[model samples]
Target: MENGKLDTRALIQTGVFTALYVVVLAVFGQLGALIPILQVMGPFYIPMVCGIPFMLFAARVRAFGQITIMGILAGALVFLTGQSWVVLALAVVLAPAADLIARAGRYRRFPLTLAAYVVFSEMLIGMVVPLFFMRGDFIARISQRHDDAWVNALVNLTPTWMFWVMIAMIAAGAAIGALLGRTLVAKHFRPAGLVT
Candidate 1:
């Protein structure tokens, strides 16, 4: 295929992936907003495991720039749909980071490199961004208002927790995504003669 045609195809694929991400996140966000217990774990949507498929698709098409586009689209969708704007900004910032990690992995050494990616990704989204955007007063108020169980849980699952809960959630999501990516790649992508 010509370069322009290839780029068009990649763009379409990325758009589809980003739309799927936004839909999934919106569903989870609704769930989290409605249910108190679900809100505690926050439905694990922030780390954006949806991006894993996009990253793999980028690797297949050798269209790394699509990652940036996917990030922007997904972030915009989230903001438009009422997710925190801070998270939208953070997604834009973190998308390139994810692309770099995916590039380094080359879709090989899935366990180690992908685990590192998930860890850093979760830290950036779940820990650092929140620490920057969320007010100390807000956190303190939440801590004060809630029982020690809730406060301790949040603290234990976050920065001091090395953001493990977020990591675990992303890892779980990514594992599923990777499995799906493998099958999809083998079927639609690999046969297209794209750059795996």
Candidate 2:
């Protein structure tokens, strides 16, 4: 970043990654629509699938703001798609924290990058926040947007204790995703010299 701002290339890269991340999120999110159980299990697998693009983005990050920008844009997109404001709020908090952590590792150290990803992935917990904190509002809102069957299924699948379980799943999924991402980066990007 020159003069404390992202230049043209970084902006373009951010746009590309942000778009990809949102697309991935949308695609996986649709699976939840088709199979309501996946919605309850989303915290575990969504991060695993999204890790490829994010780690690839992290590999390319040479500055501070890119990941944060991507996260905000992606979070906004998710919010636009009918999720809670908590998602955006968490994105604002987690993205910068992730960026800072990755920066501390110079964006290459495996363990730090993994930790950053784990933290970043937690932004998704916002999706489930309403379930715990605002069940009445969430059910009312969700029922308006979806069929009764889907909403009922989601509500049935998500017990109060499942919140903590989802958190643990996000952590495990993020770590597994980080390993997968690191492996792909090593096997594919490094060999092709796409990222160093």
Candidate closest to the true structure, highest lDDT:
2
Q: Pick the TM-score winner.
A: 2
TM-score for each of the candidates: 0.59, 0.92
Off by over 4 Å in 1: 1-6, 43-60, 112-196
For 94-173, candidate 1 gives per-residue lDDT tens digits of 66676666556553545533553453334224323453346475467666666767665655545535445555666665
* Local accuracy of candidate 2 as per-residue lDDT tens digits, 23-129: 98889878987788788778888999888888888888857889899889888999999888899999999999998998888787889989999999999999889
Residue pairs whose backbone atoms clash in candidate 1: none
User: Where is model 2 poorest over a 10-residue stretch in terms of lDDT?
Assistant: 1-10
What's the lDDT for all of these models?
Answer: 0.55, 0.87
